[model samples]
Target: MAAVLLIESAMKFAIAVFSAAHAPSSRRALLFAQAALAGGHEIVRLFFYQDGVYNASDAVVTPQDETDLPKQWRTFITEQNLDGVVCIAAALRRGVLNTEEAGRYQRDAVAVSAPWELSGLGQLHDAVQDADRLICFGGA
Candidate 1:
């Protein structure tokens, strides 16, 4: 007889990626997120910091032959009903702003879209406290 081990509890994961959208690390992070979701793990939060904030920018345009990582992230997060947060400070510094943020800073336009919101570092701290596992990608 074959024995099957079943997990009674779902694992909660928090992902933090600090790489630019075009960097290999960013793609790896996305793949990890997808895998986690596929494996029935819950993604409590997806935090983007430093150059990773660029992943939330609506202004990102990829070459015809290249993959549009930002768009892929947006679609995945949206479809999975995941919380995607971009560090406000890092985003502002990098010119990636949501509508409210643009209004707050008096910017001409909003660069970020749905499924990805601008928030403070406190969100990351909260996710760390709540999640069973915190996976970080790329260097600071």
Candidate 2:
């Protein structure tokens, strides 16, 4: 029916990330992502640029009760099949890439995840291009 179709259509939405790995911002984003997935809305893509790449790190040894920003994002994206991409330029600039990047650059202890790919500005541009609407949060 038309009503069902309209409801289904309303479920698809996009969200962007440019926030640091802080409790409030990260927790807010996790809640939003969870809501979108529960509502049957497509995340479209989560672009982690600037300080936001920390949200995609694989080894954040925070307390159990503390907000696990990386795990929350990883789990939500994997569970919901969201496209999560981390900007390579920003990741490197801000120290969030993986062992490969660390070895390549002779750095130490990179902390990114394989589920979240390293990307460039073009990827973000493309994501925004395909999304019905682009919504960015925590970008200064």
Give each model a TM-score: 0.92, 0.86
User: Each model's C-alpha lDDT?
Assistant: 0.91, 0.77
**Clashes (N, CA, C under 3 Å) per candidate:** 0, 1
The digit string of per-residue lDDT tens for model 2 on 15-94 reads 67788777476667778878766665666788877778878887667688877778778887787677888889898987
Pairs clashing within candidate 1: none
Per-residue lDDT of model 1, residues 97-118, tens digit only: 8889889889997899788888
The root-mean-square deviation over C-alpha atoms between each candidate and the true structure, in angstroms, is: 2.0, 2.1
Which clashing pairs does model 2 show? 11-41
Cα shift from native, residue 25, model 1 (Å): 0.5
lDDT of 2 at 127: 80
Which 10-residue span in candidate 2 carries the lowest summed lDDT?
6-15
